[model samples]
Target: MTTPSTAGSLRSRAAESPVDCDVVVAGAGPAGLMLAGELRAGGASVIVLERLTEINPLLKAGTLNRPNIEAFYRRGLLPVLRQAQQETEWTVSYISSRRSDGTSTLPRFSGHFAAIMLSEELLDESDPDLAGLNPPDMVDLVHQKQVEAILADRAAGLGAEVRRGVEVTGFEQDAEGVTVTTGKGPIRCGWLVGCDGGRSTVRKLAGFDFPGTAPEITGYHGVADITGVQDLGVGWHATDTGVYLNDPPRGRITTVAFDGAPAGHDTPATAEDLQAAIRHVTGADATVTGITSLTRFTDNTRQATTYRQGRVLLAGDAAHVHPPFGGQGLNLSVGDAMNLGWKLAATVRGTAPDGLLDTYTAERHPLGAWVLNWTRAQIAVMRPEPHARALREVVADLARTVDGATYFAKKISGISQRYDLSGDNPLVGASAPDYELADGSRLADHMHDGRALLLDPTGARHDLVAPYRDRMRTITTAPLTDDAPAAMFIRPDGYVAWAGEPGRDSLDEALRTWLGAPVAYPSQTPDVVAAQR
Candidate 1:
């Protein structure tokens, strides 16, 4: 192992030389920082650049969906996030319709789609289809800043260098490496990843074609001192013109106006502007005395034509952008980072199999498109037109049903997210279940090191995995679940790469395909080594 001083010297030398590090990630948000930590855990040198000198306090995402929750648990960051969640206060309200008698009914579920309440009663907790889908506190409502802070701390602890106030202006990639031009200076790296926000300078400069639908409505969020208005109880309300939500604890007010008008880019929103939007959406005379902060958003959706362009790649909002209707934006971006981190690290370390890096695009593009389409579907039903209103009513009725509610719940929580991979077992492309072993260790407890896992419940695959011990971990334990197989190969991102009974030919192929060919041991003779090779 190299000493810290020696490592610093090597980095300094590399900085002055052609390449500065193995990977240079642009942006220091949750996606970028999470990727940085993952790459560092995978033994790759990473440099994360951020345009902002200081961390922003704004809370963009108020909740972490099921997928992100499991991801955090896998990384051992869930405990930290839960601690942060305790320190932060959030006002959450369930949205539903009012009865004719003026008494409001409680929603059957905690989430909504196009203002329709998704009923939790439809979800059978004991069903096999829902296995590994729900974790403790399935939906965590933590502030976005808190999440970023946790990720940044983890990345730094893992030895990733994060530099603030360094803006990436452009980049040029050749067959050898990429030369990134930033506001400070130029830095060369083996690969570049853009985790910038929606208005990604890297995406624009790198010439990635972003194609999607235009904005359908202008949305507003603000915190203002108000008076002379009847307290519209906390929750979402859909009117003839649009939708508005008010949660008094945080002095929060939100509105979605369907006039198809975009907010001015240069002009900052004021109290008067927010009041007008609220009045239009609620048909109530609300007075705004003072505004703390006001911002505007839109349903303008766009996705990169491809996630990768040679040695340069994109993740998070830089790769895809859509309206944060069901609060899928942050979750999607974090999932992108988790999925790309290990693959990119492998590529940088020269251990990636054929087409390994390309699989990033293959696996993520469709997921991005699915999210974009999901948001678009919500916008369609939320439209103020008569036809859309009629459709929304129909959807509301269906959402109250068992099947409709379960379907929407699955989609909203991301429990149904499964990558398309070649496998006969249904669990192959799904997230691995956190199985508890006889020794009291859980599956996630073994994944924090960011290495592939070969779980052998029967303890018969030790010989098969011994050759790749450096890159893979073999856990010997009894079957923990009724659906547990004799063996399972889990990737670094917690996705199952292969699963079956022991002594299958496909198992060896999967080992070589994902973890690369095994190294020969010193005990092997020359003829055996040559034959193995």
Candidate 2:
């Protein structure tokens, strides 16, 4: 990474803040950083504004799901992810503990591919693009702090300006662009993105209303760095006391909801409470550790009414929050960042119509609602009651089967969740389609750019996609046999928005809906090129 630079120069107005940019992200967290990386990769000039002086690399978010690993790879986060593995101590065994002698057990895990049960269908059916990037050797564990540093560094390296210790106070947008007021000063930009924490300052300042279903929830948490907790294994523990353990590499982040206060209230936590809970559940004199941080909170199970509001868009915690049932928050936030980044870039660069920005909400809002629903379902099913525990145990038994394991792993990883977008044919907005290459290579190889790919089935699929080649990253794969159909249309968000025997009307509509069907490619014809020359 380049040497750290101050937010702006005090000597000159132009030097201190950018007069204009393709995108301006508020809050340089993972969502902001990942989005900045994506925009920069797509050739957009981006500015990322972070409020905190130093990275709050601690407190939460330890597990990286299979889909998240795939997203990290898409946003140029593979290297950091690789580095993150070095700091991890892999657990040979993990058990999702419960009361009355029942637990969800996974024997082995290393990287992207877990022994967990959620991915059997994809693997057994030989899904080509199911992201075979992780193995037991690399990804089951890592430090949250390290990940923050890496993503922040990658964002900076990719040409996005990231400024920490700079708070975004407010913003105003005109027909052309937006002007953001910050602690450093006022900076102008083409667009704004709010990736701030749950109580996002950007969302609040934008005057957008947040509406969603209330969580049937209450919760408390403690972040402790107790030693010897290692090799105790990884994963979560739902106890009869209405608490759960988030045992990550750094420490255990225990959260439980007992008394229903506000949806989110941070009450102080103490040693006595934890020790009592531990003894009550494990039947042992528990070893204690230093209290890094403690909080009491209630699950909101709420999502923002909309993702984009005029010039400012909310992402990550700013957009949604719920029980950490599936470890969905981080992955979903990453998805939010990836979805909005390219749209803002395209609009700023004038490749897409202004309406392109509207798709962000249309595509992601429903997905956010889905995650909230799943969390609520998990909360209800995980009440620490004998019946709930027994049901979970039954599910675990099913997980022992190959079919069951893959489903559980993939679902919990959030990789299985894809948005239902209109205009997408069978394969348009679907997960990366894994097809064979004539050269005997994997289909995922061609998806390196993180853009939508038009896969040619008859190899003739290329002829259809060639005209808009520059607008979309079209690729050629093996011929479609009876096992697979004709061609498949893949969308950038890794979902099959549309697919099937390629037809003119649906393809036209799908293209138009997603990419504004990029009116033209290269923005220059041979005649125009000659004229310019």
Highest TM-score model number:
1
User: Where is model 1 more than 4 Å wrong at Cα?
Assistant: 1-17, 91-108, 136-139, 261-263, 291-293, 521-533
Q: In candidate 2, what are the lDDT values of residues 345-394, reduced to their tens digit? A: 66654555446778789888888888887777666565677876777677
Error of 1 at 108 (Å): 6.2
- For candidate 2, the 10 contiguous residues with the lowest summed lDDT are 524-533
lDDT of 2 at 487: 57
Instruction: Give per-residue CA lDDT, model 1, range 1-533, as digits (tens).
Output: 11222434544655666688889999999889989998998888999999999787654788888778888888878678867766664422321233443223654454889866666767666656666564543337687788899999999999999999999988888766789999889998878999998998889988999999998788888777877556685777788889877768778888999887564745766777888888889887889998876777889899999998888899999999998889889899999998989888876665667677788888888989999999999999999889999999899988887777777888888888988888887789999888877776678877777888888766666667777766777777664567788788999999999988776688888877776667677642211110000
Residue pairs in candidate 1 whose N, alpha carbon or C atoms collide under 3 angstroms: none
Best by lDDT: 1
Worst 10 residues of 1 by lDDT: 524-533
Model 1, CA-based lDDT: 0.80
Per candidate, the number of residue pairs that clash is: 0, 41
Query: With candidate 2 superimposed using the best TM-score fit, by how many Å does residue 412's alpha carbon deviate from the native?
Result: 1.6
